[model samples]
Target chain A: MLAFVLRRLVQSLLVMFFVALLAFSMFRFLGDPIAQMVGQDTSLQERERLRVELGLNDPVPVQFARYVAGVLKGEFGISYRIGRPVDELIAERLPATLELSFVAALFALLAGIPMGVYTGLYPDRWLSKVLLSLSLMGIALPTFLIGILLILIFGVNLGLLPTFGRGEVVHIGFWSTGFLTISGLKSLIMPAITLGMFQLALIMRLVRSEMLEVLRTDFIKFARARGLSNRAVYFGHALKNTLVPVITITGLQIGSIIAFAIITESVFQWPGMGLLFIQAIQFVDIPVMSTYLILIAFFFVVINLTVDLLYYAVDPRLRVHGGAGGK
Target chain B: MNGMENNVAAPVADTAPALLEVRSLRVEFPTRRGTLVAVDDVSFSLRAGEILGVVGESGAGKSMTGTAIIGLLEPPGRIAGGEILLEGRRIDNLDYERMRRIRGKEIGAIFQDPLTSLNPLYTVGRQLVETIRTHLTMTEAQARRHALDMLKEVGIPAAEERIDHYPHQFSGGMRQRVVIALALCAGPKLVIADEPTTALDVSIQAQIITLLKRLCRDHGTAVMLVTHDMGVIAEAADRVAVMYAGRLVEIGPAQAVIRDAHHPYTRGLMGSIPTIGRDVERLEQIDGSMPRLDAIPPGCAFNPRCRQRFGRCEREKPSLIGQGDRAVACWLHEQGEGAS
Candidate 1:
């Protein structure tokens, strides 16, 4: 297990390195950062002085090495557009994004699993059919549209919740979160639901189908034959069996949820990394944009690694194989 | 030559109360086309401590009958009309909750494919212990001890150590033994074993059969042993019922069923068994496959395949006619047909 984790850690680092390399090269090709910094009216000597300060005159290899060295020291350069340290800017926005993603994931799991299990257990029932169609709509509609619909219903028509922005953020040392206040929480609801809708639908459908398949397995029949209560057979045997696939999809969907949050965050105007990403894109803030790309890539790698480890924990077959591989 | 027959044919009085009884049980699968009667008018009784072997080809409704008996039939297939009685109390119409209570406590089921029968996620000991606790009101410690004893009873080596192991850790035969132990753990009055040895190797098949027979005997549990193997029926069963196309063709004492079968289907089944001393061009083959549920013939289901099929065999279905302790569902057994 230790060896397996170590191997995954090494792989994660290599993946991050490649992601950094790709993002750096791509940003370099997308136009000069110096042009964006000084603007069209800036004099030539001023531009050269700015380039020298930013070490742009150095060769590509030397620049990349410096960037890698700086990254290793937790320095991600500076956002030319905002004139702020890239890491500090991202750090300020990370918590809101984390908060929104966390709530969305929590909502998806809490609502999706039970709904999926219900629909699976009673596939023929009218309620399940309704839920199935509703979930289909949830998956079919785009995130921004869902976000607009949610704001239209709850924010505009009902007047029950706040429409946009993180209302009030509470700071604890370097970290900040919006869940500490009622208005902030209410503001979070619309964006979270919009962001999580697709994930909820995906999870529900995955779980429902996987559950339908698992419930038909011989072990479940054997479980029922053993005189286990319907609850035990469904929850204990069938549900546990369904988790491997469900968890795999859920893990993959986390990356997607973060990706979709970009749109959802824009739709609600929630102040998060997604909003930062958009602004960074408009102004050609290469350092900020690259950092965001690398950070999200890092998140994907780490999430996938965690999912693999979780698979080892949940499935004995995988554990045995993992053990053999370690040997 | 027939010494083993004597041991199995210990006659019981006709009046002995049956542990499990199915009366005119009909299981149907309703489809868009029409309802397919998977099990049609099947009636049988299992007495206490009796091993009743139900033998047939695949799709003979042998497994269907067993599943119906245990109230574990999959959806769309249900008991359209029937009365299942356990010790004279009707249980077929009971709700799922009540039926569940009676299942592990009164009747146990062992299915084919032992690998699929045991949950892979849990330890074998946990599975055994949970089943024990579900029916019996045993404490956790007591259940654990009982589970350990069951593992040992099923011939699992190192029961104490191996109990923690998952289903995949055991070989196929050993897994079946665990399934057997799980089925019999609560000491239910009756066990329904559906093709228990069909998934096992030929060499390992006999061992499992013997273990099942011996364990049930020790517990005085009546067994409805459903299988397609005639050899298993011959060796393990006290009584044998031959079924074809969702109906029982013949049922009698095992010795008589094997040696003096009245139904042509049963006789054909007996003849198909290759004997070491006898040599022939090829083993006897039943002429045709068992009919699909939708296409079962109007008269006797076996008429198309039977060499002895007569004019009446195609005109009318034959009901089981009792002759002493045995019954045969064929026109040949009718009073005017032949008494010789």
Candidate 2:
């Protein structure tokens, strides 16, 4: 098991290396950062002096080496637009995005699984049909459209909740969380639902189809023949069998939730790394944009590694060696 | 169809009450086209400690009858008529929960492919323990010990160690042994072994059949062994039931049926088996396939395929005519008695 983990770690490092290389190219390929950072009135000598001090005048390889070294130490340089360390800016926005994504993920899992199981167990029931149809719309509708429609219904028309931004955050150490406040939670509902909608539908459909397939397998019939209760047959036998695929999809989807949170963040004006990344892009802020790219890639690699390990644990067939112990 | 009167006169295990009795049992699958009868008025009895081989061509509803007895018929296929009784208790119409209680406790099942029968995620020992505990009032430790004993009983080497291994770790034959162990662990009075050796290797098939027969005999568990292999039936079954296109064409003592197959379909089946020294160019083959559920011909289902099919055989379905320990559902037998 230790060897298995180490091997995955090495693979993850290799993937992160490639992403870092891609991020490094953005620095050289994108337009000059000095032009964007300095004013028109600044003298050519001042600009040249600033460029040298920032190591922009150095060879591309030397600059890339410096950037890689800074990334290794969790430093992503100063944002051209903000004039602050890119990591610090990310740190300030990280908590909100993490909280929002976590809540959205939790909601999707809690609701999607049961609905999937229900629809799977009774594919022809009236309630199952309705739930299935609703899930289709959930997958079909765009995130922004759903967000706007929800804002119109509950925010603009009903006047029941806030439509944009994280509300009433309380700071504890470096982490500022909206969980401690009611306004924060109330403001969270719309965005969390919007972000989770597509994933919830996807999880539901995958789970439902997988459940249907698992139920038809011979082991399930053998389980029933053993006179196991319906609960054991459906949940213990069929549900567990469906979980391997469910876990795979959910893991990949969680990565996407964090990466593609840009649209959701934009619609709600939620202050998070995604919004920061978008602002960085608009200003051609190389440090923040490249760092964000590398960070998202890191999430994907870590999640993929975690997923690979989870399969080994969940499915014995994937384990490298047969167990030597007995019950 | 008059099976109830002969319930007390089961050929084997004389004086023992019938362990399982099916009277006019009919299984149907309701499709959009119409109601397709899969098992039509199939009636038979299994005596305690007796092995009844339900032999037939594929699609003859041999598996269906076994599946029906265990109450595991897949959806849309249901026992549309008739009844099934176990030791005088009516079980065909019991509620789902009640039937589930009877399953694994009163009746266990061993299916064809052992590879797919056991859940892959769980160890073989865990599966056996769960089944044991479900039907027997045993603690976890007791169940585990019992499971080990079962694995050992099924001839699995290193039972103490291999018990923790998953199903895939074992070969096809060993897996079937584990399946038999699971089915018999709870000491179910009757076992429905549906095509148990069909999915095994040729060499492994004989071993599995022998294991099943020995286990069932030792435990005094009656078995309705469903299979299409006459060779397997000859080796393992004490009594034989011949089915064709969802109807019982012939049923009697296994030896008697193999020696003097009264029905033309049964004769055809027996002739199809090749002898070791025979120099024939080709072995005997049945003329036609079993009819589909939706298109089974009227009267006798086997008429289209029977070389000896007569006019009346095509007009009127023949019920089992002989009495006592033997019977044949054919127009020739019916007419022979009528003429005599």
Candidate 3:
């Protein structure tokens, strides 16, 4: 088992290396970052000075080595437009995004699975038909449209939740009494729903279809023949087999969520890395944009690796060797 | 048709009652075209400790009869008319939950294909323990011990060690043996083995058939053996029920049915078997096929295939008739004074 985890860790590093290289090259090699950063008003000598100062005149290999060394030392360099440390800016905005994204995923898992289970178990029933149809419509609707609709319903008309932004972070030593982080959670509800609604639908449909297929397998019949209750046959025998696909799709969807966060963050004006990424891009901030891209790629690869390991644990067919004892 | 009229006839005794009595059992399906009758007025009785072999060609409703008895038939097909009495208790059309309890407890089943019967993910021991646990309220250790004993009884080597092995680890014959162990784990009174050896090789087939017969005899359990092999019926069955076109044309003692078949269809079936010590010109093949459920022949279903067909055969269907030990379904036998 230790060997298995070590092997996975090694593969994850390889994946991250390629991702970081791509992020570095896409911003550094192909595009003229210094020309764009210096703008049209700079004199020829001024442009040369700026290029040398930013290490653009150095060889590509030297630049990459410096970038890797800086990354390893926890220094992401200064943003070209803001003239502040990228690490501090990201640190200030990171918590809200993490909380919102995690909450959205939690909501999706809690809501989508039951709906999928019900639809899969009773395909021809009226409730199943209605849920299936609604899920289809949900996937078709865009995040912005859904966000606007939610703001209109709950924010403007119902006057319940705040439409956007985070409340103050109260501090009492290390812990706060008015952890209105919980209250901030309320403000994030509408945008999180908009971000997670399509994923819920996509996940539900995949789960429902996969579960329907698993229900027809021989093991399920064997379980039924044992005279186990319907609930046992479904949740016990069928559900375990259906989980591999669900884990796979859910893992891949996290990558899509990172991509979707750009739009969601802009729509709701939530202070997060996605909004930071858009602002940096608009201002031609090479260091900030490269760091964001590499971080997103790193998250995607790490999430997929965790899911792959989980899949191996759950399915004996994919186990490293003979399972249990196989490292 | 005249071969099995005299030897080992069936006797109706007032003293011994049938442990499982099925009378006028009919199963039908509502297809898009019309109602299709799958089992038409099939009747048979089985006493405790007796092995009754049901023989027929494909699409003869043999498996359907087994499914109906176990209450496992899928939707669109249902019992149209029947009385399935187990220990004098009516069981036909019983509620699902009630039937489910009786299925693996009172009446266990071993299907033909062992590859598809057992769950691929679970170990054979796990399945055995599960079945035992469901039927009997035993502790996990108790169930495990019982399962190990059963695996040993079924002649599996290293039963304790192999209990943890998955289904894919065993060979076909070994898997079938595991299935038999599962079916017999509850000590069921009646075992429904539907073509249990049909999927096995010739050598393993004989071994499985002998094992089943020996197990039933020792436990005093009745077996409803469904197979198309007449040779197997002669070896393992106490009585034989011959079916064609979803109807029972002849049923009697195994010896009588093998040696002196009464119905034309039965005679054709016996004639088709290749005797080891005897040489014949050619094996007789039953002419034509069993009629489709939707397009059954006008009157008698076998009239088109029967070589002894007469003018009256086209106008009337035959029903089982007898008062003594044996019953035969044929117009020729009906004419005789003591033919049954």
Candidate 4:
């Protein structure tokens, strides 16, 4: 087991490296950051000097190598326009985005799972029908619209909660621990709910349908024949088999949540990596933008790898196969 | 000996009452065509320590009969008419909760596929413990002990250690044994094994049969064994009931049916069996398939495929006849024309 875990870790490193390399090159080649940086009134010599200083004149391989080395060393170069360290910009904004995404995921699972399980267990029943109708509405309505509506009702109209900005600051001694504490939590709720509604709607439906299919399997029938209680037949046996597909969808949705965050965070003005990304793009801050892109890519790869490993834990059969986590 | 048949059959009816009595049992399914009578007025009784094999091809309603006994048939199919009496107590009208309570307690069932008869997620021990607890009202530790003992009794190798393993860890035969163990865990008086050995390899199939026979004998559990394999019936069954078109065409002692088949369908079935010693061109095949129950033949359903079929055979539906000891359903015997 230790060897298996070690092998997976090694594989993860290789995967992360390739992912970082591809994201970096694509951001560099597809759009010309230098032109965006130089702007309207720049002399040719000045621009050339700027380009050579940034190693833009170097070969693609050399450029990539330097970028990777710099990233590892925590010196992500100065933003071309903002002139701030790219790392600082990212560090400032990442919390908000993560805060939103994590809350959304939590809401999705907590709300969606029971809703899905109920729907699957009792198809067309009143409670299931109500949940289905609610999910359908959730799917149709956009996340940004939901966010706006929430702000209007809770923040603007009722004045119960703060609408736009992060909540009032509370002083704490430690930055690392402080971020996970009360003040941070208070600031995160609105944005998290905003981003979470749509995901909850989508994931609930997937889990319900997959669970319905797994319930009809012969194994479930056997469980029933074994004189297992209704609870055991439905939840213990049926639900366990359905988790594999659910985990896959969750992995895919994490990537989508990141994409959705770009829009949701922008709408809510929550300072997260997504907002940093848009700022980097608009100002053509190449170092900041590239770093943001690679970071998102790294998260995607990491989330999927974690999901694959969880599959092995959930299903004993997959533990024997070498590619359980990889697959 | 032939002239003194009355004396030979006189003592057959003085035996003990049947262990299971399925009286006028009717199972129906609501299909697109209409209400299809899957098992039409089927009635039979099983004796303790006897294997009663029900033989029929697909759509002959053999499986539905088994499912009906266990109350496991899903919706759109229901017991339209009948009384199911186990140990002479009526059980057909019991609600789902009550029926489930009686299911693993009084009666146990093994399905066609062994893979389906065991949940793949749980360990063998867990499943056995679950059933044993449900029926026996034992404590957790007691249940675990019983489950381990059952696994051993089922012939699973290293039952104490291997019971911790999941269903996929065992072979098909082993899985069937686990199923048997579960069925017999509550020490039910009756066991319904529906094609228990069909999923196994040929050699493994024999082993399972031998094991089942030995176990059932030891426990004195009456068994209603449903299968299409005549060989299995000949080898393991004490009595045989041959069904065609949702009706029992003939039922008698296993030896009687194998040696002296009364119904044309039974004769055709026996002739169709491929024997090792005898070489014949194209084993005797029944001329036609079973008729759709919705539009059953005007008179006898099997008359279309029967070679002994006569004018009266197509005009009248034959019912089971004869005294308690001996029974036959045919026009030839009714007229005393085919009587020996």
Candidate 5:
């Protein structure tokens, strides 16, 4: 078990290294931070000294090692556009993005799984057919369009909810949460729904197909024959098998949720990292843009590691020794 | 030898009422083209502790009949016209809850492939314990202990250590034994074993068959053994029913059926089992494949393939006709023994 975890940790480190290398190398060519930070009247010699101070002229490998060391110590330098430490800038917006993504992910799973199981168990039912048709729309329509439609319905026509922004956030230590206040939650509804809709539909479809596939397996039929109640046969035996594939998919979907939150954030004007990253792109803020890249890659690596561990937990076939597979 | 004929046939039927009985059972599958009859007018009875082997080629409806008896028939195929009774009570029309209650408690099933039959995600012990708890009112500890006992009963070595292992950890034969253990853990009165040994290595087949026979016999569990292997019928079956294209062609004492098959189809089946001493260039086989369900000839479904098919054989289907406990579904036996 320890060895398995160690192996995953080593792989995660390797993935982080490659992503850091890519981010550092790719973001440098987008003009220069010195040009963005300094005033127009600054002397050429002053600019050169600043460049040397920032180690811009250092060898690529040495700079990378220094960048790696700095990242390991939670330092992301100063954003070229804001002239504030990039870590501090991200920390301000991190809560909003994390809150939105987690809520969206939870909505996708809690609602999607039951819908998938229901549709799978009774593919011929009227309700299942209706859900399936509606899900098709969910998948077909673009995320931004869904957000616009939601805004139109609730904000413009019905006028029941706030249209944009994280309305009223409550500060809790390092975190700022919308969940603690009604106005904040009400404002969050449209964007969260818009962001979650596609994932919910995808997860529902994936789970439904997987449930169908698992139901056809011999063990499920054997489970039925063994007189395990319909509940046990369907959920206990069939659903668990379906979840193996579902877990891998849901993990990837969560990563995409955070990555794609840029569209939702821009649509709602939610003050999150996605919105910051977009601004960073416009102004060529290398530190902030690169930090976002490294952060997203880190999320993927961590999620994938968790997914592998979940596989070991859910499936006994993957357990090589007697240690980790607790009876 | 003519001396083999005995009126006291069907093993234990004379001593006790049938544990499981099928009266004119018919299974059908509806397609866009038509309703296809999979098992047509199949009727048989099994006495407690006796083994009744239903042998046939692939697509002969032997497995279908077994699945129907256990109320686990695949969708779009159902028992369109039939009455399956266990201990003189009709079970075919029971609701899902009632049927589920009966499934592992009174009637258990073992399928062809053991590798696929057991859930890969669960420990064999967990599978066994769950089935036991489902049918039997046992506490968790009691069920676990019962499961261990069952594993040992099915001949798994070191039940304690191996019970925690998953299905993939076991060999094919060992997996089948675990499957058998799962089936019989509830002490079901009847077991429907559908080609239980067909997927195992040849050397392992005999061992599984022997274990299944001894365990069921010791438990007084009547078994409907469905297989295409004639040698298996001869070895383990007390009585045998030979089916061709969804209908029973001959049924009698296994020895009698193997040695003196009255139906030409059964005779061909016996002849096809290659004998060691015979120097024939080719083995005997039916002349044609089974007619497709949609296009089955109007009379005997096997008539086109039967070498002894006559004018009457092609005009009308024959029901099981018998003397004492023996029966044959063929035109030759429609009248008396010598009518043909």
Candidate 6:
């Protein structure tokens, strides 16, 4: 198991390297950063001086090597627009995005699994039909639209909650989070719902279909014949078997939830990396944009590795050779 | 010979109530075009400690009859018109909860594939203990002990060590033994074994058959053994019921049915068996396959494949005609003075 984890770590590192290289080269092609930084009226010599200061005068390979070396030493170059270290800017916003994704994932699991089990158990019942249709609507409607609709209902029309921005933040060392305050939680609801809606529907459908399939298996029939109660048979036997596939899908969905939060953040003005991303793009801040891209790619690899470990933990069949002992 | 003697002794004292009784049981499956009859007017009874072997070809409805009695028939298929009585109390119409209580307590079921029957996620001991605890009141420690005892009873090597192992750890025959142990652990009055040996090897099949017979005999639990192997019935059953195309064509003491089969279908089945000492150019086979549920002919479902089929056999279905200690569903048998 240790070997397996080490192997995965190496693979993830290779992936992150490729992702960083791609982002670095792609931004260079988007247009000269110095040109975007200086005004058009500036003298040619002033522009040339700015270019030299920024090390834009160097060859492409030399620049890439310098960038790689800087990144290795934990230096993501200063943001051209903000004139601050790109890492510090990202670190300030990291907590919000992390908190939002965590809350959204928790919401999706708590709501989606039960809904899936219910619909899977009784596919023809009226309640199941209604919940299934609602989940379908959740999937069909886009994140930005859902965010606007939520604002209209709870913020604009009902006057029950605030619609835009992080309300308050509590700083702990380098990490700052909004969940420590009541207003922060209230503001979190709309964006979290919008970001979570698609994941909820996807997980529900996955779990429902998987449960339906597991319920028809011979082991389930044997479980029923063993005189287990309907509840025990459904939840204890069928649901347990359904979880492997559900966990796999849910793990993959977490990566998508983070990606999708960009639109939701835009709609609600939530202070997260997603909003920073849009701002960085608008200002042509190549360093910040490239850092964000690499960071998200790194997150995807880590999440996938965690999912593989989880598979070993949950399924005994996968833990045959040395896996059990390692755990 | 021992099985035949047991059969003769079965009816000696007729006062004891049958452990299981099925009266004109019909199971049907509803399809897009129409309802397909899977088990048609099937009726049989099992006395306590008696093994009734139900032998048939594929699609003969033998397994369906067992599933119907156990109330585990897959949906779209149901007991259309029938009564199943256990100790004189009707069980065919029990609700899901009540039926669940009866299963593994009153009537235990053993399916064909051992690998599929046991959950891979759990240890053998856990599954056995759970089933035992569900039907009986016992502490977890006591249940675990009982599970270990059952494993030993089924002849597992080193029961104490093996009980903690998963189902995949056991061989095919060993797994079937574990399944048998599970079915009988609750001391159920009856066991419905559906082709329990078909998935096993020829050598292992005999071992499982003997194990099942010995266990049932020791516990005095009646058994309904559903299989397509004639050899298994001959060795394990006191009485045998021969089914053809969802209907019982013959039922009698194992010796009588094998030696003097009255129905043409049963005769053909016996003839199809290859005997070691007897030499023949080719084994006899029934003319055609069992008819599909949707296309079963109007009269006797077996008429298309029956060699002795007559005008009456092709025009109308024949019900069981009772003789002394035997019954045959054939027009020839209906002509006898004692026919019913």
| Range of the 10 consecutive residues with the lowest summed lDDT in candidate 6 chain B | B1-10
Give one digit per residue, the lDDT tens place, for model 5 in A1-327.
889889988988888789889878877677777877789999999999988997888987788888888888988888878889999999999999989999999998998999999999999999999999989998999999999999999999999989899999999998999999999999878888999999999999999999999999998989998999999999889999898899999999999999999999999998999999999987877778878988998899889889989998998777665432222
Candidate 6 chain A weakest ten by summed lDDT? A318-327
Q: How far is candidate 1 from the true structure (C-alpha RMSD, Å)?
A: 4.6
Candidate 5 Cα lDDT to native: 0.88
TM-score of model number 1, chain B? 0.94
lDDT (0 to 1) per candidate: 0.87, 0.88, 0.80, 0.78, 0.88, 0.87
lDDT of 2: 0.88
Task: Give the DockQ ranking, best first.
Answer: 1, 2, 5, 6, 3, 4
lDDT per residue for candidate 2 within A40-140, as digits (tens), equals 99999999998898888888778778988988897889988999999999999989888999899989999999999999999999999999999999999
**Poorly placed runs, candidate 1 (over 4 Å):** A57-59, A321-327, B1-13, B336-340
CA-based DockQ, model 2: 0.51
> What's the residue-level lDDT of A242 in candidate 6?
83
What DockQ, on C-alphas, does every prediction get? 0.54, 0.51, 0.31, 0.26, 0.47, 0.46
For model 6, residues B11-73, the per-residue Cα lDDT tens digits are 322566788888788899999999998998877788899999999999999999999999999
For model 4, the stretches where C-alpha displacement exceeds 4 angstroms are: A1-11, A28-52, A57-61, A168-190, A320-327, B1-15, B276-282, B335-340
- What TM-score does candidate 4 reach? 0.90
State, as a TM-score between 0 and 1, how close model 6 is to the true structure.
0.95
Candidate 5 local lDDT, B1-340, one digit each (tens): 1122222123233857888878778899999888988998888889888899999989988999999998988989999886899999999999889999999899999989998998888888889999999999999999999999999999998889999988888888999999999889999999999999999889999999999999988999988999999989988999999887788777888997787888888888888999889899999877778777778897777888777778987878777777566888787886657424
Candidate 1 lDDT, B1-340, residue by residue in tens:
2122112222233788878878778899999999999988777788999999999999999999998988878888899886789999998899999999988878998989998999999999999999999988999999999999998998988889888888888888989999998998998999999999999889999999999999998999999999999999999999998888998878889997898888888888988999888878899877879999999998898888877778999988787776777877888888835423
TM-score on alpha carbons, each prediction: 0.95, 0.94, 0.89, 0.90, 0.93, 0.95
- Candidate 6, residues A62-175, lDDT tens digits: the string is 777887788999999999989999999999998989899989998999999999999999999999999899999999998889999999999999998899998988899998
lDDT of 4 by residue, B1-340 (tens): 1122122111134368777877667888999878888887666788888898999888888888888887888778999886788877888888877878777777888777887667666787888888888888899999999988888888988888888877777777888888899889989888888898888889988898888899999999999999999999999999888887787767778888788887778888999999998978889998868887787896678888888889988987776555444455676666535444
